[model samples]
Target: MSQFDAQILVAAFELSYNDWTLGLRKSNMQVDVLLQNEVLRRGSSILEQTASSLSILPAENADIEGSNLSLRYDDGALLILGEMSYFDLEGLFVDTDSFYLTTGYRFGQWLPHITYARLNSTDDDIRRAPRIETIKNNLPAGSADQIAVATVQSLAPILWNQESTSYAIGVNYFFSPQVVGKLEAKMVTDRNGTISQFQNANTSGASAPVIPDDNRILIYGLSVDVVF
Candidate 1:
C-alpha cells in the first residue's frame, strides 16, 4: 500500500514503517551503517456529541455502560530521513487511489511528512427498539382467582445500516541519529458514505436508513519505545 520515488540527486533516501520495524533505504550517498530506533506516541479520545445518540438507551458517564463503542481506528507512523531523502524542492507525489503521500524538510530542524488512510465503519449494532405490553383479564365471579396475561403489543423496529468515513493525517519526527516522536489525527464525516441504510417507525414494509448526527471528535495519544 506504499511507493517510494527516491530522488537521491539531492540527498540520501531512508524510510521506515510501523515504528522503524519495516525499513527501506535507497541513497546515492554511502552510509557507514543504517541506524534504527523505536518511535512512540501517546494520545486521547475526544468524544463527539452525536456519539451518545447512537445508542438506544441514555449513554452514561461510561460508568453505567461499557466503553463508548467506536468502530473506527487511528494510529501514528514514523520515518527516519537523512537515512533516506528524496530530491530537492521538486517534490514527489504518490497516490494510493484512496490517499496521498507527502513530505517536507523545513526550518532546518523539522522534517514533516503527511499521508492519508481510508476508513469505513459499517458494523454498528443499531437494533430496533423493542415493544412490550401488559395485559389484565377479569376473573369469573368471586369464586375464581384473578387472571393476568403479558404479551408483546408489537416488536421493536430495527435501525438501518450506518456508514462512516475515517479520514486521517499523520506526522513523524526524523531527527538525526534518533527518531523523536509521532502524532496522528482522524475525523469521521457526518453521514458520509457511498451507500447507507435507513429505518422507519411505520413497522410496515422495509424502512429507510436512519440518519446520524453531526459532531467533531479528536483522538490522540503518546507512547515510548523502550529498548534494553
Candidate 2:
C-alpha cells in the first residue's frame, strides 16, 4: 500500500537500505535518511520466451530505519515477489532484501529475462543502555548510589530486519520454458538501545557493555525454466 512509512513503532530505531535491477547494466541513485541505521541490496535473472520476443529488466532499491530486519515483497508492481522476516531491538540481528525486473517474449519453446541488484548488512548492537536497581545495604552501606543494585541494561527492545539484491550482465544460460530453476541471495544486520523507566525513584544495576556480532550473510542460487 504505502512505499515509505514516517514512523515505524511496532519496530523502532530502524535502519534503511537499497538495491539494483537485474537486466539494468547502468548505475543509479536514491535519496532517504534514517536516524539510527541503513542498508542496501541487489540481484538479477534471465529468461527467453520466443525468437522474436524477449524481456530484459534491471532494478534498484533503498531502505530506511533499518536497525533490524526489513522484508517487503511486491508482485510485479513493487519489483518484488514474496518474503518472510524477523527483527529485534535487544540483540544481534539477521536480515535481508531484494528487487527483480522482468521482460519476456514468446519465441516457440524459449523465454528469457535479464536482472540486476546489490546487497549489504553488518554488525549491530542489541542493548543500548545499562541499568542497575538500588536496594538497602544489608552487608555494608556504601554510597547512596551503590547500596543494592539490579541490572536492567537490556531494557531496550531488540529490533531486527534484512537487505539483499542481485544482477546479470550479458552471458547467461537456461533450459525448459516452464519451470527451469531460480537464483537468490540476501544479507542481515541490526542495532541496539536501552529504554529505562524508574520504578521507586529507583536505581539500576551496572550493565556490561554489549558488543554486536557480524551477521552479514551471502546468498547464491540457481534457477530453472519450464514451458507448458
Candidate 3:
C-alpha cells in the first residue's frame, strides 16, 4: 500500500472584548476559537493496526477544537498570549491536548519574546503503531541479520504515556512597518521520549534501551518576514 495522504480545513471566529488605555499605557484583549477537520486517504492501514506498528499515527478522520487569547499593552511594546488545543480521534480511541503561553516586551523597534508549550497524549497504544509497515518495506535487502533484528524490534509496541515541554526565546527587529527579522533559540524536553518501538539489547529481562527515552534538544533559527 502507498503512504497515506490527508486533507485539512480550518475555520475560526475572533472577538475583541476590551481595548482600553490607562494613563500612558494601552491595553487590549482579543480571543479566537478555531475548528479543524481532516480526512486521510488510506488511513486505516496506519491507524487501525495492532500494537504491532512502531509509530503513533493520527486517525483517518479527526477533529480539533482550539482557542487563544492575546493581551497587548503599549501598542505592541508588551504582549501576552495563551492558547489551548484539543483533539478528538474517537475512531482510534485517542485524545490529545496542547497548551502555549507567550510574553513579549519591546524596546523601540526591537522585541524580545519568551514562550512555553506542552503536549499531552492519552491512550499510549494508539500513540505507537503507525509506521511499522513503512519501515519494513524500506529496509535493505542484502542485510538479512540486520533486517531480521529490525523487524523484531519494530514488532514490539511501546507505551505512549509521554509529555513534552518546549521553551523558546527570540529577538525580533522591525526593519519597517512591512518587514521584520528574527533570531530564536529553542529547547525541547521530553519525558518518556520513545517515539518508535525497538527491542532491548539485553534479553535478560531488562527494558529496551532507555537512552532515547528522555531527551533535551537545542535549536537555533533565524528568519525574515515580509508582509506584501
**Which candidate number maximizes TM-score?**
3
Ordering by TM-score? 3, 1, 2
lDDT of each: 0.28, 0.27, 0.51
In candidate 2, what are the lDDT values of residues 1-228, reduced to their tens digit? 013223332422322244322221112223122212111110011111111011011121222223222333323223332222222111222223333443333244333444444332332231221211112222234532222111111221222222334444221234543455445443323222211111112233433333234333234556555667
User: How many pairs in model 1 have backbone atoms within 3 A of each other, for residues 3 or more apart or on separate chains, i.e. clashes?
Assistant: 21
Tens-place lDDT digits, model 1, residues 1-228: 112333222222334343343333332421121112111000001011223222222222221111111121113323322211122111011101122233333444443554433322222322221211111133243221211111101111222233433455655454543545566676655435322222332333443333434443345645433333
lDDT tens digits, residue span 72-157, model 3: 34445667776666654433323556778888888989999999988776656643434544544564654553354343334322
Which residue runs does candidate 1 get wrong by more than 4 Å?
A: 1-109, 121-162, 175-179, 190-213, 226-228
Per-prediction tally of clashes: 21, 109, 3
Error of 2 at 210 (Å): 23
Worst 10 residues of 2 by lDDT: 38-47
TM-score of each model, paired residue for residue: 0.26, 0.24, 0.55
User: How large is the C-alpha RMSD of every model relative to the true structure?
Assistant: 22.2, 20.5, 11.4
lDDT measured at residue 22 in model 2 versus the true structure, 0 to 100: 23
